[model samples]
Target chain A: MVQKYTSMAYASADDLVFGKAKFPVKAGLGLEIGAGYTTPEINYAPRPQAGKSKEKLIKEYERITTDSMQRMVQIGAPSVVLETEHVEQMTNNPSWGGEVAHAQKTIMEEYHDEYGIKCALRHTPGDIREDRDFLKLRGDKYDLLMESFEQIAQNGADLLSIESMGGKEVFDYSILRNDTAGILFGIGVLGSMDMEMIWSDIADIAKKNNVVAAGDTDCAQANTAMFIAGGLLDKNLAHTIAIVARAISAGRSLCAYEAGATGPGKDCGYENTIIKSISGVPIAQEGKSSTCAHSDVMGNLVMQACDLWSNESVEYHGEFGGTSVQCWGESLAYDCSLMNVALKTGKEKGLRDLFTLSDKYRDPQGYVLAYENAYRVGQAIVKDGTDNYLRTKNAAVECCTILDEGIASGKLRLTRFETKALAKVQADLAALPDNSDQFMSDCLTKYKEEVAVFRPENYGL
Target chain B: MLDLKKEDIDGILIRYNVSLEKEMTPDEAAEELYPKDELIYPIAKAIYEGEEDDVIDGLKAAIDAGKNPIALINDALMVGMGVVSQLYDEGIIFLPNVMMSADAMLDGIEYCKDQTDEVPEPKGTVVCHVAEGDVHDIGKNIVAALLRANGFDVVDLGRDCPVDEVIEAVEKEKPILVTGTALMTTTMYAFKEVNDKLLEKGIKVPFACGGGAVNQDFVSQYELGVYGEEAADAPKIAEFILASGDGIEKLREEFHKH
Candidate 1:
């Protein structure tokens, strides 16, 4: 059905690149970061905490925002969206308006001062009200929420992003097409975003909104979106493809901003650029081993996910679907130094494996098919290792150990969970050639040895 | 590829068919269509196609002819269902087709069960649900359908289920594997709650969590929690749980081993 629109979205999507937004696009080897956070304290808040005085809340945000912004600069982010300052509201309670406003001001001041980086602030969806009709009726609170974005925009913020519970609300708001100046809306389909409700209107909303919509990192949500978009597969294939589509669709400039939650000890989402690439359409991922153990895992994930595409294509269509012009094939990597910065022994082994392998295959067009083929072989390894990965105690420890060794050797760099060992690994890996086979092979041998020791047979599968 | 003639429909329908279309009680059809050699593939195909009338008549004819329900289910109905699943997976078919196929398969199976007089062992009950705050259940539904087709007795808790309900199911059913799915961060933590509650209760069921908001790393962090990377991972987890012989700690330990 042809969709009717309600409002104009003023944000210009012309500046928005598909894959990696923050990182410059390098024809040879591009790197972009996945920036943002999902602080659980906000989600698992104290009941009274939700109603914390704006002054108190803004103070807390001030501390968090300062750190987050500083980290963005340190990590080499070209542009950063100031994390949303507004919290979901509870009805008939003390409002968080005061704190949210203060946080907004703090972010604005910092962004204006730090002109080197592009800044965007997300609009809060406001408190959960059972009155579904409130927004339609232009209820006072709903009007206030819309006015909040205007206030943010008028206050000299570079971009205004509207966040809701999911896409359905966005569709209902008719903002995707609003395309009004300085205003944009991004939808998150992952985690608690109503898939069925949102899906019914998403494509139309996207078309009407004409605002670029962000796909999620959640495998199921992405898969559901893909299926609704015309791809079909069993549950397993769906999950795998969801990651690929979400990443690939994002393209090179904004690969890191592809929506997913990241925080300490959360696995529902992955952090590596390689997993992001392989899981979705191919694109270059930036940063070093932030959420992964070694560069090899990025290569491993990319190759494997690519293999799923290639193999599935051949099985059904009898020919590998080339990386179409629409799909730019690039290697993705992540920070894998989170596991350890302390244990000094296996650091070099992990670093060498990642740098050497990824460096050799960094060419986007040259080795696309080959990468996919190698990934198919890796799938077997993943399958075989499934039993080991499932182990609660020994397996978790072993995986952590692998992460630690890579970080120490300078091969893996986990941004969120930093360790001293990672710096050493990064320094070592930086010295290696971009494509040295001999160096890679030596690294692999050492990795095998480390795996033998750190992750003994009994420890894994 | 085997082309059985339309006339062969007599044989295929003799043992299985949807009773809604055939105007026969499951028991009546079972007694009359027993040992029917003719009613195999066609009846199964009819069920897969959701040919309600044809399926009912076919079951009765097959049963009257003395065909075993298990054989008909395995050879025809199951075969057709497999084809439907493959088609659905390949995008050749869709969700409605699968639901229709499942409905047809179940109708014939019911007749057979009625005839057998012995209850089929619930092939390892599994507790499955979407996590709290996560309202999307389409993915979960697909998993449920596939699991049921693969011979699992699924204790489906439906969409947007609370963590407590999931824990209660684990406590009540003692399923070999309990799974939680969340499509959003809003509800993914419900998995953690289930994991914590089960651990608290000393029930060591393998907890598999998957969906858009779920990640293997997060699942690995929790005790007794095995992050299901996909919906298909559920059956594999169930297999592991059953093989462990109710070894909950072993299951937890095994999940973390990766």
Candidate 2:
């Protein structure tokens, strides 16, 4: 039986520091994450040409893994986590994902044996539900997805992760209109239910295979908001709403841990910081180093409390400096080295404070991502942890209060437009009924008629 | 009442990385970011401030003073949104501000439409959808909104739309252009499938594909594909398609920054 977190794992947020966790996970040749030192987690994707055939895909994986491992050894890297996020084609063909995982893990093991470099292979298969109907998680596609996970784990994957998409149809609709109630239902309630079901099965699979079910990411929900709010894609969503959506996503992502998966959690889930504070699990975070893949405002700030520093994902192709994976891996390794040096010198908190203060005043998203603010949000999340709705709602309200205080104290700056948007978000979140049942009832009645694809049965409402 | 402690003040300053002597008030920081203008300033202010009622009042007053409704939309409302768009580009304003401004601008447009007897016709119709298996549609929504604001009719297929649904919409709507967005590498392949099916049916309605996962290299690989670099670029691309023929090669040459 898997233990679930019922209360805050640490006595205080101050006790929650980088390179340490209440429950550190050991994987692949004595490489421990969240123990006492930080490690680089390098995530890379095969080039588009690899999609030609399974053999080609496997070859590409081998090349990338060998190249990355060789580079790590050359740089005298302490340890690394290599994550293989299977594409749609690989997941559709479960053996393909298994073959790739086996190929990469073989190389990783070889490097560990020959060079004494600690490494772990994290296999993240694609969520194979082609349509938005996540409720129908039983079909050829669903079976293939589950089969891919089993094969990857059995084929030598040390860690299992999936960017699961549930309640996203409603989340998309609700976030467009900045509807707080719809967000609460979609991410908090519906999303939590789906995570429980899927993660419970995944945790069982991990246990059976002697692999760790690392964690799930709210990439579809929180990352979408983060991407949009970062102003690269669209500006129709506000950073204020994005930060709140992130807080709500923390409750949903927490369901994965509750279902028995341990840390370090996925890197892209910006909500991972708050989850780390709550569950006291190791968390992998990506920011400035991930610019090769994406951009965000919290580049420096998100690094404040990360155990596994990652480069998100770089496509395995040649660059001016080197191959994409090698160059980005070096970037991530250097950042991890800096953090490790700080940890060794007992200046980790000083470095963490620098990371926090550099970007904390730049954006409200950054402001809330600061370790202290993340701890406050974590406190709100656990305050009503039993109820998904209340915990997520409380987290959102807490984030808003943090932003308000930051703005009030002139620690953070915002344009008039942003100030107004923040006010609107606060007002909208505050307007929701305090009772979870009332909020659920109101959302069911309102969003059922409003969001066209939000089926009550999908969430088992 | 003023219980000021030196350590407390030092702690606050150190944590925030701000000196008490040089710290600016929130109002002082906001003062420089606000847009300034004369005739159209109030309407534009209403747009950036996201005050819909204020926008409507300003529109009604401008219309009462005998300004052209169409010109008011172009000069006042769109201009107001333009300020927001610029502020957003400069990082002075954020997404929420843009969303509220878009709402206020749309409300102003609707009010203007009601007041004017002769409403201008839209440039053309465009079908927009997020790619199959991808639920992120805020980018698509913004694209549709920008297209509509630029006087183009948009048939948004919403998020996670099936390829068959998109093909069916194209068959029925016969729009001048089609757009798809996908936020994941796994899901972005759906764009290629949609393009292939559209080509199989001999429906080459210039698909403008973009999102976080998509780039020019991916979009340019297929026929009738144009990479939309930003949501704001949607209107310009649509106008180009309306004026110039739907030549995918030319569209890719003109757009697709990378």
> What tens-digit string does per-residue lDDT give for candidate 2 at A1-461?
43445577777766666788889999876699899898999988777557768998899889999989988998999899999888777887888888898889888989899989988999888877645533454456667778888999889899999988777777876776667777778888888888887888889899999989999989988887777666422344667788888988998999889998997899998998889988988999999999989988768888888999889887788999778888999989999999999989998888887787667766778788777788889889888888888888898899999988987886575655556667887888878898988887888888788676666765556
Give the DockQ (C-alpha) for candidate 2: 0.17
* Maximum-DockQ candidate: 2
Which candidate should be chosen as best, given lDDT against the real structure?
2
Provide the lowest-lDDT 10-residue window in model 2 chain A: A130-139
RMSD of 2: 6.2
Per-model C-alpha RMSD: 22.1, 6.2
The best candidate by TM-score is 2
Off by over 4 Å in 2: A1-6, A130-144, A231-234, B1-122, B129-138, B149-151, B155-174, B185-205, B220-223, B243-254
User: What TM-score does chain A of each model score against the native chain A?
Assistant: 0.32, 0.96
Error of 2 at B33 (Å): 20
